[model samples]
Target: MYPVIAGGALSAMTFPGQTAGLSVFADPLIEQLGIDRSTLSLSYLIGTLLGAAAQPAIGRLLDRFDARRIIVVIAVLFSGVLFALSFAQEIVGLTAGYVGVRMFGQGALGLAATTAVAQIVRRRRGLALGVSGAIGSAGISLAPVLLERVVSEVGIATAWRLEALAVLLVVVPIALTLPRPAPASMEVQRTSTGTIIVAGYTARQARRTGMFWVLTGALSTSAMLSTALGFHQIGLLGERGLTPLEAAANFIPQTITALAATLIVGALIDRHDPRIFVVGSMAAMAASMLLVGIVTPGILAVIYGLVLGLAGGALRGMEAAAFVRYYGLTHIGSIRGLAVSISLAASALGPYALAVGAEWAGNFSQPSAWLAIIPAGIAILAFMVPQPSPRATRPS
Candidate 1:
């Protein structure tokens, strides 16, 4: 429970550096810099792409050093980045700030928090991840709202400066309290599919397995679809004949369903095989896309929110647990880092892909229907993948 609480707190610390947090200042920044929307987005994308590309290295560092020490450094640096962002006067300044925020805040800080908890709790990892994810998610949800209020009162620059101060004064102190443990000393064993325990598979070895690719593919696809839809949700809802208020109201159902599903999935994965969650998440994603693509508004719309929310919540919980469950924690940081990079790259591509699809098909429904086929196929294939043995003997 302590590790879980720490993980959740660290996750919340990512708010100032995440996309939602940065978005609040977008309008004011653009207005001040005299740039168009496309230009600003392009700058942001470039920065994010570079940051994503560096995740594997960051993961290696986690494996090589004390996570608590690393997290403290990252938090302090992230604060500096926010400070830099507040004083940006040109495109280059914004780009540097974006890189700092994405690389340190989103990538390294987030990775440290989760990995710390995973290191601490071996048996009930599912529950720990579930609680941390839920708390982290709540932090993300509140970030934009909080930033908006601050921006309104103090203005964007001052708001950012305050955020920077909060990170240094609040986040770093909490980070210093995190536990530091020695790496696992368990013996290594090789299996038909992958290595098991202590000397866990390196990122290269992990990628060689069918299970690794499938799990990564499933997660990447989820990230792509979820991010794309979220980016255009209001517009999509309007196309379905919903007023602004109705569309906003749908978030209530989604949030409730997501919270409920997260806790349930968390508890279940600890007791049962994790593969069930993989299949369930795939099915929920497919159901969500199909529902939103075809169903009429009214009650069905709320149902769509529930299914979508479940998919998101469950998928996140499962993905976090799967790395340790299937691959072992010896080098979990490096292995998970590669997986996260792929997911982030997919997220970047999703909006563009969906936009192109909408333009070509003349409506979101057609593209959404097409997108639904991806998870459906993955769901069929997930069944064939076997559960990895927790510890296997080395071949002699």
Candidate 2:
């Protein structure tokens, strides 16, 4: 229960590095730094790509060291990075700031938070993860609104410093409060209920299996398409005849739908095959992309929001559970780390790809429609792939 609470807090804290969180300050930063939107997007692309490269190593470190300590370190560094980012006056400084926040806040801290919860809660693990994700995601969804108020009141630079302070005050203590892990030399540790064995395949062995690629593909598709849509939300919907406020209002339905879907999928994953959720998420992504190509300012826009929310929430709910269920807990960090790295890299590519596509076609519709094919193909592959047996393998 303590781990669950701490994990939820850590997850919520990741908002500082998430796309939705950063989007709040985009307009302000562009104006303050005297840069065009394209230049800012390019910086984000390079920074996120570089940040994505750090996850595999962070994941490996999580497997070898104390996650609680690692999380503490990450939170402190993340806070410092956010503070420094507030002072950036040029592209190079802004890019470096993005690298720091993305690496520490998004990549390392997020992986640690989920891995910590997944490591300790064996029985009813799905419910624990679901609750944790729900809490975190709810906070993430509300971040833009909350930060907007702060930015409006105190200005972007001070808002950033306040956010940094919040991270230090909130995240560090919760991380410290988590229960200590059993010693690494212990193969079997006794919980309050009974003894449990820590077992799972190493990262290398998991990579050799077909299920790994199937799951990764499904997860990456959601990350990429959703991120692309999010990064270009105002512009994309503007092209479809929606005002900026109307486009932004759509997030309310999307966030509500995402919260519901995340909880439902989380509860169900424990009893049902995870592949069902994987395939369903991809289908939702496909539908949303196709819908985005033709959506209007009213009902169609809301429906698009719901479908996109479903895609994002369902995938988020099931991702940790699928990895733990299929791969086991012993080496879960390293295995899931590799998958996260790929997903993050895919997310980096998404916005840039869509931006370039939009430039080529002179509108978002053509590029959005073309992107649908990727997830549609992945959905078919996920459905065709057989489910892996939940057998524990000896860690190397």
lDDT of each: 0.78, 0.86
Q: How well does candidate 2 score on lDDT at residue 265? A: 92
Off by more than 4 A, model 1: 186-198, 295-297, 387-396
Each prediction's TM-score against the native? 0.91, 0.94
Per candidate, the number of residue pairs that clash is: 0, 0
Q: Find the 10 residues in a row with the least total lDDT in model 1.
A: 387-396
The reply for model 2, stretches above 4 Å from the true place, is 182-198, 389-396
Best by lDDT: 2
Q: TM-score winner among the candidates?
A: 2
lDDT at 370, model 2: 93
